[model samples]
Target: MRRWRGRFLARLRAIAPRYPPRREVDRQARADMAASSVEGGLPGRRRANPSMLPRRIPLYRELIRATFQPE
Candidate 1:
């Protein structure tokens, strides 16, 4: 058991430096998303459908159209 544990830990330590920590990976992903968004890259997630707005809210529909379909 002791030998196995030692081998496992030694292998882990040797491999650890090859990968960034989870938090660092997440931070980098967020930064990349922000940069892409600023550059008008494709959205990472689906956007809401403007057609889903109630007919009573013409202003909302117009705003959505104006924002997404710029003349």
Candidate 2:
């Protein structure tokens, strides 16, 4: 019974995905982010402007409607 259990655990370990250590994973993520930023693959945050509120917000939609009335 003990040998069978050990063999089963070993087989499971062999089939399981091997993940990098936490520190290594973090380092890789940082490196990827840095590379993407350098290559312009990642977008930077938009500068805060009162006139440029996100369109998805109700307040922004109301502001747009108020600013542009139809003749």
Candidate 3:
């Protein structure tokens, strides 16, 4: 009985290759599709430092600070 059960389980396992679970497959598919140019997507983002400004715009910071100060 043990031999037969083992053989049955083995045959069942052999019949199928181990595929990633459905959620992982869906996530990879989404990532791949998004990576393609046709999908019009970017991988990540960048943010500029708050204090970083062009030398030409030195007065812009002072102007903004004065404009928005609480009355």
Candidate 4:
């Protein structure tokens, strides 16, 4: 089972794309596709340094509370 699983995975990896598309006449299309897919995705919040951001005080408090709460 293990040997067959390893061979199957190796074959799958070999079939995957090996490089980014080379830029050419299709560069605009590729760029637009990439931008639409990536930028249209959800907005993400970056974590500011806790000491620099007062908002993180309550976040840390909640996290600590959840960690110690009985499960």
Identify the leading candidate in terms of TM-score. 1
For 1-70, candidate 4 gives per-residue lDDT tens digits of 3443455345334433442222222333423433333333322223333333344335534533343334
Which parts of model 3 are misplaced by more than 4 Å?
Answer: 18-71
TM-score of 1: 0.29
Off by over 4 Å in 4: 1-25, 43-71
Between prediction 1 and prediction 3, the one with superior TM-score is 1
Query: Per-residue CA lDDT of candidate 3, range 1-71, in tens?
Result: 34434553454344334432322223333323323322222222123433323331445334323433334
Q: Show the lowest summed lDDT stretch of 10 residues, model 3.
A: 37-46
The estimated TM-scores of all candidates read 0.29, 0.24, 0.24, 0.25
- RMSD in Å for candidate 3, one decimal? 24.8
Question: In angstroms, how far off is 7's CA in candidate 4?
Answer: 38
Error of 1 at 45 (Å): 48
Candidate 1 Cα misplacement greater than 4 A, ranges: 23-71
Model 2 lDDT tens row, 1-71: 34434553453344334432322223333334333333332122333443233322445334333433333
Question: Please, what are the lDDT tens digits per residue for candidate 1 over residues 1-71?
Answer: 34434543454345436543333233333334333333332232234533332332455334333433423
lDDT of 3 at 19: 31
**Model 2 TM-score on a 0 to 1 scale:** 0.24
